[model samples]
Target: MANRVDTLVATSPIKCAADKFYNFFKLNMNELVKIFPLAFTGVEVLEGEEGTVGCVKRWKYIIGGIPVSATVKIEVIDDAAKSITFAVLEGDVLLLYKSFKATLTVSEGSAQWTISFEKSTILTPPPELYIPLVITICTLVDAFLLVN
Candidate 1:
C-alpha cells in the first residue's frame, strides 16, 4: 500500500487558534513534543538545528531500539497568504505522506491550524503501542475522588 496523508486533527488544549497555536507550538514545540519522548523513554535528538537556521530548522529524532527514525527539515514561509509551510526532508515513511505544510490563522484568541499528516496506512504503527482504556478509567476514578 502506498503511503498517503492518513490522519489529521486540530487540538485546542488552550483554545488557541491558527497563528496563536502556530506561535505557541513554534515556541513550545520542543516541550510539547517532549511528551512522546518521556512516554517511550530512550529517545534522543541526535542532531538538529536549535531553531531558524537561515529560515530552515533541521530536526533529527531517534528512539532507542526502534529501527525507525525521522528527520524533518522545517521551513517557515511568510507569504501574502500569511501561512507557514513545514516540510520533511528525509526519513522513514517518506514515501507515504512525505511532507506537511500548513497555515495558522487566528480567530478570536483561538487559532485554527490545519495539520496534515502523511501516512501509508490508516493504521499508522508506532514503535510501542499501549492500551489506555484501563488507565483512562483509573484516571477518571481518581479525578472523581478528588472532586467529591
Candidate 2:
C-alpha cells in the first residue's frame, strides 16, 4: 500500500494529567463521541478492563447506519513515566497501516497534552473520515463541560 499523504500532530491546550477534567473524561468517552453522526451515532464498548499493567478500552462506532461503518479499538497504555499511548486496532487504519497508532504524552509538567497520529489512510482522504473525528472529539469535550 502507498503511504498516506498526511500525518497530523495535534497538541492540546492543557496538560494531560490526572485531574478533574481527566477524571470526568473517563466516564463516557466512547459514547460521547458518537452523538454527532448525522446518521448512525452510537459506540459500543466491548471491553474495559483495567489492571496494574494498563487499561484496555475497546470500542467500535457504526456510522451512516448499519452497513457503512468505521471502527476503532483503542488500547490505552498508561505508564508511570507520565505518558500514555493509544494503540488503534482494526478498521481501515489496520488495513492500510498495519501498525497504526497515536500517542498522548504528558508535557509541560503534565499541564498540556500533545497528540500525534501516525495514519495510513488514503493520500487525500475523502474528508469525511478525518473531519468527523475532529468534530466529534471537539464536540464531545465541549459537551462534557456544558452538561456538567
Candidate 3:
C-alpha cells in the first residue's frame, strides 16, 4: 500500500509587517535562542549559510513542556511570497514520524504554519501539539518586532 501524507495548518494574526516577520526568521533565526530562551534553547547551523536554500540548521526547542531537537534543511525560500520551507532530516521528531516537512508563510497581518507528514505507524498520532507552539512563537516574535 502507498503511504498517506497528512497535513496540518495553523494561522495566527500578527501585529508586525509580513516582510519584517519573514525577515526575522530568514535573517535572524540564530538569535531566536537568545531572544526566546523559554521556547528555544539553541539554534545551530550545521551546514551552509543562513537564509540560503540547502542550509541545515539544528534547533533545540521546547514542546509539550519537554525539550526536543530537530535538524532540518532549508528546502525553499520565497522572499516575494514571504514563505520558507524546511525538511526535517533527523532528530527527536523522526522518532514518531516517517517523514516531516514544515512551511511558514507570512501575510499582511497573519502568519501561517503548515506541517506535512507521514506517520511511522497508523497508531501514531498526528502532530497537533505543535499548533500552540507555533502560535506562541508568532505572538512572541510579533511583540519583539513591535518593540524593537
Give the winner by lDDT: 3
Between candidates 1 and 3, name the one with more favorable lDDT.
3
Candidate 2 pairs with clashing backbones? 14-111, 14-112, 15-111, 15-112
Tens-place lDDT per residue, model 3, 1-148, is 2599999999999998889999998989787787789989988899999999999999999888899999999999999899999999999999999999989999999999999999999899999988888888888899999988
Score candidate 3 by lDDT: 0.92
Worst lDDT 10-window in candidate 1: 126-135
Q: What is the RMSD of candidate 3?
A: 1.0
lDDT, each prediction: 0.41, 0.44, 0.92
The prediction achieving the highest TM-score against the true structure is: 3
Query: What are the RMSD figures for all models against the true structure?
Result: 8.7, 5.5, 1.0
Order candidates by TM-score, high to low.
Answer: 3, 2, 1
- Which of candidates 1 and 2 is the stronger one according to lDDT? 2
Residue 32 of model 1, lDDT score: 32
- Model 1 Cα lDDT, one tens digit per residue, 1-148: 5656533434232232334444443443454334444333232333544334223433434334344444444466453343454555556535545455443433433333455665545665531221232133223323332343
Residue 107 in model 3: lDDT:
97
Total colliding residue pairs, candidate 1: 9
